[model samples]
Each structure stands twice: as structure tokens, then as C-alpha cells.
Target: MRFKEWDDYIDCLLRQVKFRPDHDDIRAEYEEHLEDLYGELVSCGVPEDEAAKDAVRSMGDPVEAGKLLNSVHNAFLGWLERLLRWAMALLIVLSVIPLLSVALAGGESLIGMAGGYRDTQEHGALVYSVPVGESVALDNHTISFDEVRLYEDGVFELRYRDRLHLFDRAVKWSYDLGFSEVRDGNGNTAKGGSGSGGGSFLSRHQQYFEGFSPDIRKLVIERRGSEYAYKGRDFRIEIDLSGAKEAAGL
Candidate 1:
């Protein structure tokens, strides 16, 4: 559906600006935007011609807008945003390739990467799972330890199975579940494994740490006293890595 009024505004604007690929894109976007606004106004008891004029007016100073866009589209900055998007999308697809290939080949892939009931391999990693005897009570929910895993590259992860109904079930590991000798990370990814209604609750926490020596035998993850005062006593997770020394091929 072509609006004569909209086409006129775009034609007038384009005349003031040099013809370029960017201008075409901008013109198309503006056309859609104006059409939407016009449709909305018509739905709300506004005449089509009046709506078209009002929409163009709202954009303000057609000549100035065209000049600004002409400058923007010419510079490297014009295509930078789109270039970055394509780059990021390509990177994501590349990263998923390894996982997808392994899965399709029937090799041991996401079978254990996710909190699945698979045997943890100890060849390259001190991979194994163990249950926790204690549980931490936070507000209305009690977080019980489901399992803990130590990967090949010293990548440590904790899986919590039981989670009560709640919107935000974030645990401040530094304050809530403190690892006295471990270090905290700035940006981390936590994917809820095996939850109700697909993935409402249940979480897996990955953390990095320091303070390891050649003789260091175990990685102890302990929580500092809770500040919420919900759970009275403090509990800890001790991952025995007698075979961990060999994981690094030391």
C-alpha cells in the first residue's frame, strides 16, 4: 500500500540528499514507520491525509534530516552496527558447531555438559558428581545441593536440584555461599538444568578460584555465614580431587 503523501515526503527528502544505499534503507524504514503511524491514527478516528501530514511533521525539518543521514551513511559508522551484528551471529554459529557435530556423531557431547545423569570422565578432567548432605535455606526457598563437577581445565560447576517457587532465585555466592579461599567472577553464565515447566527453577553455578599448590589435594567451596539470617548454620562443599593432580597432566 503506497501512500502518495508519504512518497512525496520521501521524494522531497531524497532530493536534498545524495542517492546512496543507506538512503534507500532509511527511506524504506521511514515508509514503514509512517505507514504504521498512519494506520494507527486512522484506527483512532484520524483521516489518512491528516495522519500522513502529521507523521511527516513529527519527524521535523526534512532537509536537515536528509543532510544528517547523508553524512551518517557515508562514514564507516553507518555500516559498523550491521557489520558487528553479522560478525557476532557468525561467531555464535561457529561456537555451536563443535557441540552439534559431537551430538550428531553419537559421541559423548552435552550428555554431561548439562546436569544429566552421565558418568563424569576423569581422563582429561577430574569429572565426577557427588551429593551434598546439607541444604541452605534462603528466604522462602531452601537450596539443596544436587551435584558438583570439576572439569578438565579446572572449570568448576555446582548444580542445585531443588528450588521452590520464585521469580528471582539468584544466590549471591560471595555473600550467601562464600568460598573463603576462592575468587569471585564478574561475568558468568548460569543455565537452569532440569526444572519444572521446562525451566522455571534449578540452577548450575560456574566459578573460578585461586590458592592452589602442587600439593593441593582438594577444592573446598564453603559458604560464609548467610546475611539473610534465614539459615542458621553454615555449610560447605568439599570436592575431593586426589586425581585432580593428574587432570593437568602434572
Candidate 2:
């Protein structure tokens, strides 16, 4: 078991084992196991390199070692994946209450409207719409709005907001029919920009697009209660659906 060229020999063996199509983590575990056995051998009486060769002898076949390592590592990875999935499920369940609270609060103000909304994938575009008042004149295949209704107390008022995709301009629109909240955001990584101070609408919007890059010419649309913000390479569009159900025409 005591040989001089042990480390070099074991290295060659391990390299050869890798060519047999074993799992990578299995190979890594066996590699570490071999190193530990070598350390124990040296600690007893053998020379450094000789101890390594003795260690390799005790390791059985390289293919067998790889199989054992595969069993252990597969179990470990399965456990880790389950833990991650449970963590995600827990996070989503906990977040639901807070999200509902915000939606309810936003629905209370005059700028807020009560209605059902739907999102459809059609005509190579994503469409969202809210039907106000009777809901009949609103429900349709196309997402574009022809009319909207704003509700204050028990009164219903008509309003309209148009959608457009513009490029190379920083455009802002007022969510309130009377221009109550403006979704104008300006900030950099340094200054803690405009979104921090103005427009709760924009603050929530920035959260939605946390990792997305922004376009300087992006269009900002302010509906009654929320901001629909999106950026593209040549063009950008931000839709404010804050008080969308009550806009004007429905």
C-alpha cells in the first residue's frame, strides 16, 4: 500500500474515472473522500505521497466510489430543492394579504373605480381591461378602451384615456381626471430620485420593474390607481390604470 508516486497515480485514476460519464457532484465527493483518506494515512506513519497511494487502495473501485457519491449527493440535492420550493410557496402565501390590502385601499378613493378586469393574449399582444358600470359595453375581445366611467360616491362620470407607444420622449400623464396624481419619476443609483417623493403609483411601478432597464424616451401613462410600466429597446410605454374603470366613457 505504501508507494511513492501515489498522488500522480490517483490523479490519473480520477481523470480516467471522469471519462466514464459519472455525475459531476459524485466525482467531486469521491475526490474529497480520497483526500481525507490520504491525510489519515500520512498522519499514521506513511510518507505524504505514499500515504496518498495507500488511501487510493482503500477507496475500492473508482466507479464504485462514484456510485456511492452519486447516491449521497442526489439525496442532498433533492432535499435542497424541496427546501427551496417550500420557501417560495411560503413567501407567496404570506404576501397575499398585503397585496389585497393595498388593492382595497386604492379602490376606495375617487380616483379608484370598482369593476372586473381581464387580461387576454390575442393578436400578438397582451391586453388588460376593466369594465365599469353595466360591464356589458366594456367586455370585449380587444383590450383597447372605447369609453370609461369614474365613480365618486354613487355618481358616475364619463372619461377616456388613450394608449400610444412613443419613442425617445419622457412623457407623463395624469391619473386623475382632474390631474390629481402625476406619475413622474426621476432618479439615479445615487440621488434617491423622484419616485421616492412623488407618486405612490410610481413607487409601486419601480418595484415591478426592479431588474428591468429603463428607456429615456419611455411614455408614462397615469390611470387612476396603478402604473403599467414597460420599457423596450427603441420604444417604451407606461400605462396608468389607476382609475381606469372610471375614466370617462363607460
Candidate 3:
């Protein structure tokens, strides 16, 4: 139960508190304390009116109390504290957004590795298949050749995976496994190929070439040229196709 005396005392106390922004909070605190004190006094057999008056009196002079509270809750410090809290919140949001993006990209990469391989295999009859499983460390990436598939229609497909090192992953930078130059054992270049790939942190890649020959005993895949080609990194993968030729009955 609220009494007029308690209301009047709190109003007077709040008038002396210079920080208007904190008035509501301070008022609530004082009201809660007075209610508790008033309840305790009434439980001990004091009359309701007397209990209310005693609770207000026990709080001491409102003016002096407000002055002490005003000193403690400096307006400038209150505003600075609020500003720092907001800044910390913003910093947390900024940090988490990139991590979420990397996680999402990593998920998409896994899905692409599974789905894209299945889609490519459906295009032609399987003539020869080999698991290369070779890795080369270049720049900020460890590029691994997972498998190679050649179809009867001269479609050559290479499945590879690449992972960015810790530092590169932290900065959200990615490595591109660009077009590779394919050559036969007799130094004949295989032409006309297209590539597609996607991912972050760790990524899967697929490159397709046309006019591959089953008679070729050796195949050399080389990545070269400017940053636009293979991000300025050079590496060679030499694959012996003798087994592929025998398997395909060439």
C-alpha cells in the first residue's frame, strides 16, 4: 500500500538528483526499499500510519540523501559507461558475422563436393578412373588432387580440394585453383576446357577438359601464369595414364 507521505518524500528526494536520465531507476530503488521497511514495521504491530511515517523518517533527510546519490552517479560517467557498453556490443556483432559467413561457406563447400561430383559423372559413360590423392603446398593453400575421371566421350574431369592456412582463414581470404594446362607425354597440349568451383576455409574444385586420348601413356597437369591464372603460384601434377589406357583397352 502506497502512502502520500512516502510519495511526497520520494518526489522531494528526486528533485535534488541532478541526473535526469537516471531519475526513474533511482526512484524505483527508493520505492522498493521504503516498501520493504514499511512492511517490516507493520508486521511488528506498529499502526499503518505510524509505520509509513517511520519508514520515511528512517531514510534520513531527502535533500542530503539525493546530494550523496548525485555525487556517486555522475552524469558524464553514466553517459560514458552507456557508450562503452554499446561499443562492446557492436564489436561482438562485427566479430560474429564473419565467423557465421565462414561457417556457411564451409557447409556449401561440402555440399558442392558431394553433389557436383554426382552431376558430372552422370554426363557420360565411365571409361577410366584414378585416385591421384596428391597434395602441393603453395602460397597460403594446400591443394590436393583427390581423383580423376575420364569418360568415353573424351570428357576429362579432375576433382580436387584446397584449404587455406589458419592465418588466411582468419582474414577471410580465399585461394583460387584456376585453369590448369594439360599436356600428353609427347608434349601435345589438350585444349578447350572449362572450370567451376566454390567454398571458403576448405573448398572443392572441378575442372573439365575435352579431347583427352586413351592412348596417351602419361599426362602432366601444370598451373602457371599471372595471379589471374593460378594466383601467381606454380605447381605440376604428373599422372601416369598407362593404367588408364589398359583399363580402357586402348
Candidate 4:
């Protein structure tokens, strides 16, 4: 027997198998076993042709082996197993998509928050900036005051963020910083400023007011009510502008 003869024997055996998909794997396994047996017989002093013949004989009748393998490799079972493997892979990919989307959205929001002031400052010259880290708790939400900026164009910018308490129940709500009124130390009230705010968990707000007296010593932000359905309690944020005024030589 030769190598060609061994291949012919395997082809004959697989002809009886019903599951066509398992033919390659079964062929490789049978070939490996035959090679090992043939090598052993030749190492024991048997001729190459005789070793191949003995190896094939030791494996038994091809028809009988094929019938046994056909029973084990049922066509239905092989296809079902392949389908299940594919389904499992698809499920894993589907599960990860939403998580990746949420992560990307959150990353973009943080980048915006970090660079928001710099983008706003590009429009005009920055005259003075004062960091006034303050917080006011309303119900389960806490509003934080980050800083105040004055531009040479008479625009007063207030930057803040609103966040929910860590252990608070999840609820859908939004606060508009534009709803708050700005008052100077001289009792002059300035209302209706343009602003923009957005975020997923921690919301960022930027309110821009104009025409402030450069000699102003202090400023106050008073919020009486909200335009949204969830009207929060009244609150006040008093910002000392003395530092800003002095820095700007006022």
C-alpha cells in the first residue's frame, strides 16, 4: 500500500458518513493515526509497503468504521452545533455594542466640559477670571459654581454644573441657568441672559450676561422658579467680583 492507497481508503470510509461538514476533520484524524501506526511498524524493521498495509489492516474494515462514525456524526447534530456556535458569537457582539456607544458618548461629554470655556473665550478678550467654587443643595440635586469670567466686550460669563446626589433615586430633570437673574452690588438687576447647557449625568451650564458696570464690586444670581415641570426651590449664589474688578484696574 502507498500514500495514495491510504487516501483512497479514507474516501471510501467517509462515503458512508451523512454529515458532509465533518469530512475534513475525520479525514485528518484518520490520516494522523495511520501515519503513527505506519511509522511504528517501519521502525520495528518491517518494509515500508508492508508497514502501510499492516497499519490499514489494524484499523479494521473501512465500511464498518464509516458506519460507526456516521451514527456519531449525525447531519442534524453537526449543523445544529455549528448554528449554536454562530448564534453565541453574534449575541456577544450585540451585547457589547450599547456599552461601547454609551462610553463614547460619555467621553465626548467630558471633552466638551474641559474645553468649553476655552472655546467661548475665543470670541472675545478675557479681562478677568475668578474661581468661585460654591455649591447649593436643592432636594436631591446639587448645583456647583465653578468660575466667573469677564470679557473686554462687556460679557460676564458664569460657568456651573448641576449633579444628582450619589445615592439619590434616578429621575429625569433639567435646570436652565438662564432662568436665574443677575444683580450687581448696586442693586441693579439684569435678567434674560443667553446660555447653553448639556450633559448625561452631570449637566454643565454657561450663562452670558452683558452691560455690567466695570466698577461693580459684587454680583448675585437669584433663582426663584424653574420653567420646567419640576420647579425647584428658590436659591441664591452671591459672587464677589471685587477681585475681578481690582484685577482689571477698576
Per-residue lDDT tens digits for candidate 1, residues 166-245, read 44546523222434423222222222222211122333333333223324445554445557653465555555556654
Over all chains combined, what TM-score does candidate 2 have? Answer: 0.26
Q: After superposition, how far is residue 179 of candidate 2 from its true place, in Å?
A: 25
Candidate 3 local lDDT, 82-106, one digit each (tens): 8999999999999898888867877
Model 4 per-residue lDDT tens digits across residues 1-250: 2487688889999999989999999999999999999999999999999888888889988999999999999999999999999999999999898888757756765765665553365438878888889888877778888888887777777788877564577674665655336777766776436555446556677777766685577888777765873376777778888767677665
Model 4 misses residue 120 by how many Å? 7.3
The all-Cα superposition gives candidate 1 an RMSD in Å to the true structure of 18.3
Query: What is residue 183's positional error in candidate 3, in angstroms?
Result: 2.1
TM per prediction: 0.30, 0.26, 0.71, 0.55
Clashing pairs in 4: none
Best by TM-score: 3
Decide which is better by TM-score, 3 or 4.
3
Ranking by lDDT: 4, 3, 1, 2
Q: 57, model 1: CA deviation in Å?
A: 6.0
- Candidate structures ordered by TM-score, highest first: 3, 4, 1, 2
Winner by lDDT between candidate 3 and candidate 2: 3
Candidate 1 residues lying further than 4 Å off, grouped into runs, are 15-25, 28-61, 71-74, 99-250
Model 1 shows how many backbone clashes?
1
